[model samples]
Target: MEINEVQKWIKSYYGQRGWTDYGPFIRVGFLMEETGEVARAVRSYEIGRDRPDESTPPPEQLKNDLIEEIGDVLGNIALLADLYGITLEEAFTAHKEKLVKRFNS
Candidate 1:
């Protein structure tokens, strides 16, 4: 699905979960937490080792962990844009133009 569709899906899913009351700060917090989880998953993937005590998730779990964390990050980011009254399409367009000027020069 496109980014716009993804944003709508996140809103619908969370709204159903009684998460409609959370503010931008709450979404930012979730974004940060999910990012950290993605980092940990990457670390485990990079280290290629597992702990006997299960301090880290096994290698097989790394892929799914990253997927889940990344999805959460995207969902929260969409919520952030929505909270600020910005459409995801407009944000994407502005961001792409910014990148092109910064990198295509």
Candidate 2:
């Protein structure tokens, strides 16, 4: 699904479950934790890289872990946007517009 669709789905799901008070600090903490996980995954990947002679668990595993971390980050971002009453479509559009303006300049 698109980012906007995912955001709407998340907002609706949480809203229905009565999770309306998403604080910025909480989201920040979540992001930090997720970032740590991503770092750990990267470290693991590096360790695997250094052990090419040994039986490696395959690069796909590390890639999957990284993808999971990205998903976690996206989840926290969606929560943050929901807390601020900002839709994903609006955020994406605004950011794209800014990038276009910067590039044109």
Candidate 3:
């Protein structure tokens, strides 16, 4: 799925649920919360937690959790981008192109 397609899907999905009514501040707050969840999932998946029960999730389960959390983060990011009137594809490519030039130099 392309970023533009994903962004449109996100917009439509959120547009139906009253999420589009929230201000940028609320959207950003949700984005930050989702980011934190992604970070926590990554840490738990990479390092065995102190709890014995969490030593290691089955590979399938670990992958599922990571995917779900990352999806959440991406959704929130799309919403934030929508709120700011930013096209994720353009923004991502432009920013990445700058890095590409910097590295190639």
lDDT of 3 by residue, 10-91 (tens): 8898899988888888888988888888887787778745686545777677778989999988888888888778989878
Per-residue lDDT of model 1, residues 12-100, tens digit only = 89889977568888888888998898887777788844678667666677888778888877888888888888878999899999999
In angstroms, how far off is 80's CA in candidate 1? Answer: 1.1
When 1 and 2 are scored with lDDT, the better candidate is: 1
Q: Which residue segments of model 3 deviate by more than 4 Å?
A: 52-56
Instruction: Find the candidate with the highest TM-score and give its number.
Output: 3
The global Cα lDDT (0 to 1) of model 3 is 0.85
Model 1 worst lDDT run, 10 consecutive residues: 48-57
TM-score per prediction, in order, is 0.84, 0.73, 0.87
Could you tell me which 10 consecutive residues in candidate 2 have the lowest summed lDDT? 48-57
- For 1-105, candidate 2 gives per-residue lDDT tens digits of 987789988778867876646578977887789888888778778775456575656789888888898777777789888788898788889999999999988
Q: Pick the candidate with the highest lDDT.
A: 3
Model 2 CA deviation exceeding 4 Å by range: 12-22, 46-56
What is the Cα-based lDDT of residue 92 in candidate 3?
Answer: 97
RMSD of each: 2.1, 3.7, 1.7
Q: Cα lDDT for residue 77, model 2? A: 81
